[model samples]
Target: MTATVRPGLADEDLARLRARVTGPVLDPSTPTYDEVRRVWNGAVDKHPAVIVRCAEAPDVVEAIRFARRTGLPVAVRGGGHSIPGFSAIDGGLLIDLQPMKTIDVDPDQRLVTVGAGVVWAELDRATQEHGLAVTGGEVSDTGIAGLTLGGGFGWLKRTCGLACDNLLAAEVVTADGRVVGASDTENPDLLWALRGGGGNFGIVTRFTYRLHPVGPILYGGALVHPAQRTADALRFLREHASRVPDETSLMAALVVAPPAPEFPAALHGHPVVVLGAAYHGGLAEGEHALGFLREFAPPAVDLLGPIPYVALQQMVDAFTPRGLHYYVKSEWLADLPDGVVDALVDHHLARTSPLHQILLHQMGGAVSRVAPEKTAFTYRDAAFVVTVAGCWQPGDARGPHVEWARSAWRACLPGSAGGAYINHLDADEGANRIRAAYGAATYDRLIAVKAVWDPDNVFCGNHNIPPGHSGTRQR
Candidate 1:
């Protein structure tokens, strides 16, 4: 099992690797290789030399060992939805975790344990059955691994804290192909690193989360207005965000209405500003906390109502379906001033791409309450996290869409807190942006963790935090 890592692949070594793993090992020649390699991002078209559909941590350990022996770059795919396409690799080894879909819920303990491959929807469905949930990605299809590892946000974020915040423990296969458990009682520093440190130190095979009571239904919905009202909506969100209860999540978006039967045909293919709100507290308080959206000049479309928490999490699924060509840039802004609002309206909102949109997630409450140094997810206390996402079909020209997204992101950067969300970073944003995601101290600490668990950086495919020697191990 221990082969000296070299920078070339050997057929005999590959054969030995295949013989050691329990999962299905696939090469490019395999009939289903193409299908197996496909990821959720249409923009990604990587073809890893070997694809290991890991069924468990042992399978992962073998794959990592083989890849390290061959010195082949490695990529890990959980839900297969890395916006920056880190879930795949070109001519390397792909550790596809999708086959590890084991999930268990302990209702009495208020906890849920899942394999890395589990997506938000699958986990949400299981947890909802037990009347417990955690803060997950807004789009249900997003993989739990990538989201939680990079500071997950969603409707529950403001009230219940981030997905990383709920993390209790994890079982990961370190770079050296050793199985390790990370929790307060064991390898606690690794647990802290896994909370929001990206996939730097190791590959997580299983996760344990502390769940909160989230019943079947919640008060939440969206209010849509004309695109011309972008500024008005932005201003309203800016003012309204500060006073909203910790149990409430108020967010906004500027997007083109999809031509679905549920929406007015006349409004289809056009831009609009959407104000979406959710409350996990009392119904009466929820009404009072979110009624401001309706009073802002009767919306063109009002879909606000009492809806199931699971259903509410899926409201964004339509616009963010699998395989959509997407490019994203984000910023953490303390407040949405007039200049920022104008920048969005004049530069981004004026243009319309069917699925492209600007999203503003109002942040505070439980998320900000956690000290910046509590976890590797140091980007905190920002009034809002704004994202400019350009989405289009695969056949369309990617240039214009990418450029448009970049332009909008740049316009908002000047008003930002000089940092980006680790999860939202585009591949091209480079190291500086990654550093900005976690300020100096936090980033340094993360690097130290990486040094301990993954000294040679075998898992460098994600928003990587390379192993370092300067800082002492936090444990």
Candidate 2:
């Protein structure tokens, strides 16, 4: 049930807002106040004055215009996975897009059009039904909007490309409150700006990405190893990563084995070096290509084999559940130095939270082939994307978890290229980090586009690039 406005908003204002949309408007006194305030990163706690659950494209337009007219901040929420809480704004308006999730497949042209709210799991299931796939977020629960808008990464990168590379078109609501369609042919500048660029341009209503014939089931899963073997595992994986074919994409995570039925009873609550993988190839070919991985001693358990593409996508979805205190930091590594691996192993053992993890994803192959200028997404030649994530409950444990993530991230930066992935980054990185992510040239172009589309900088909560930057620096 809706609550009557009591604090900042007046009764008349609430009535006007209610008249603009058919969806429910949740204020501070709403029954589900606590639940609606929650986001993927539990570390971020924001209370938007109103949460508008949009039912149609026009509702988004109305919400944008209303927020602008009333001078209230507007946050767009799809999967609520914005680590910095791009989904929620203090004393503002939140346009919750979760209800708009829908996927329409054009099998004839190998394309899939997805609503902004659709998660990776939903999209993977839909496309895999036709023996087709598109690059998506590494975690299943990641919303299509934030991930694709910020340049999504996943198991299919080496084989196909990034999520942005597969993008065919997008239906967006600009800051000026106009609905527009963007693609290579139409609004080419806007299309280029959207690629790899975070949600600085507008609130994307729907995304249409080109698809590839991936699998109904193919070789994929994790190879778990003991914590003691972490060093060896890291070295083996890094050395072998480059030699693997484009059809094979792999990543390794240092994490504690959860106390779940899927994990070994003895290994429960203990740290493990998990080498997870997915190969878009037949069993025999995948086996032949991945033979080098077996040299690190047989895995504690080999969950690898022919599994449905959708199944592989959802494999780690449960670990990163909807509402958890999450603090993540990332850097792009051109090469994994010997000392860096040792530091990572040390940090893995030092984590107080069992949910803490460090992930190293192999990037390049087809991903690197994309031109630097074609889109706002840069760093085409980076070897890997390394993310340090701390997940825990809020309260007494918050400081320790966030500190652990920061320490791990700082320790690993010396071996990195000093660039951050917009999606995996925490708020601590701030604006300077955004500049580093998109070099001088790309950032300048993005700012010009921002001036044209969102001159007032209405979408400023993300890895923001303000309107008047001559280049990457503040000056």
Candidate 3:
């Protein structure tokens, strides 16, 4: 049905929109309007005029067409976890994809097909049933849409590849209200652009990925150490990471230990450096490889052991839930030098809030083998990707949390390769950062593709590139 031309969308248009989707339509007058509008990042406060919980691809198409015809801004939400709350917009139309989550696995071919709204946990559970897995977001609750769109980096990243790398194909709804499939063969150029191009090209409805034998069990978990040993731990981590097999992955976070029964009461609520290890091989080999990390001079807490991969992914999600203010900055480092370690240690010790954390994921292995130009993801050879995240209870504390995150980011900027990951970047970091994420040449190609698929910039809420007169679509 075509959109109604009446001001504020005549009641008839609302009825027509509701008729097209199986999910609920929430407006300002709806009882659950406020709840429906909330996103993962509490800091981003927006009030979209209408929220359409799309139940299928046709529902998405109808929402996009209606929003365009009405000349209203459209924001697409999958997991509601975009750092800047790009998933939702104020006084606009929100295309909520949460209700469309569905996962199907072809065990014989080792391929997994999932809807845009599927979260890491949902996909992980389904794939594991077939003794197969794919690279996914680190946290279980993270939406596959935002993560894959921005080129996912995770525990399996070094061993396999970014989530985008394993992507075999996708069904996307373009800005002009057309449905198309993108893969290495069909619409190849659009597929290339979608790899690490953010959500600028179109609204992805489903993704097909090549799966691997990951696990019901991976040998790894968090091993916490005292705050004073931060420097020593950091040095050891860097050296040990270089020697580990590609199948083994590790991540380190400097933060306060949560007050839980699993931890010693004395260490609870205190600053500590935690190491998360994941080894995708024999238990004996994993234990042997983890010996160096396990012998870290009487750790404050030692939770590292053999556990289900799905459980590990869900571990950190409990701490970083929705309705919390968050500010983040990320960088890819070629090497973690001594000076950089010192800076990280100093900042951690000086942190005024316990909510602050510095995340380091050792990158390489299968991820770097892919040619730079082969896909849209360009940061192929970096040694590590460090993310500085400040999550706090919203309200008066927001200022201090943001300030701490910003200061830490500024201090570490020089230590980086001069760019930020498009996924973790805060909304405040503007166009220059986006340009840096995709260098000059790549950015130019992305702009050219933007011209063909979305010349009018209907998908401007993401890290955007305006279309030009270039008739040839680049990338």
Q: Give the TM-score of each candidate.
A: 0.95, 0.96, 0.95
Across residues 24-130, which tens digit of lDDT does each residue of candidate 3 receive? 88887788889989898888889887899988888889988878877778899988899999998888889999987889899999998899889999999999998
Candidate 3 lDDT for residue 3:
39
Model 1: per-residue lDDT, tens digit, 1-475? Answer: 3222233667788788778888888887778889998888889998888889999999999998888777788999999888899989998899999988999999999988999999999999999998889999989989999999999999999878999999999999998999999998999999999989988888999999999998578889899888889898889888888987898898999888888776688888888889999998666677777787788988888888788999999998888888889899999987787888998987655563667889999998999898766678886789899999988888999898888888888888766876988889989987777878887888888887888888777888887776784333322
lDDT of 1: 0.86
What's the distance in Å from true for residue 319, model 3?
A: 2.0
Q: Which ten residues in a row have the lowest lDDT in candidate 1?
A: 1-10
lDDT of each: 0.86, 0.84, 0.84
lDDT of 2 at 185: 90
Q: Candidate 2 — which residues are off by over 4 angstroms? A: 1-10, 470-475
Poorest 10 consecutive residues by lDDT, candidate 3: 466-475
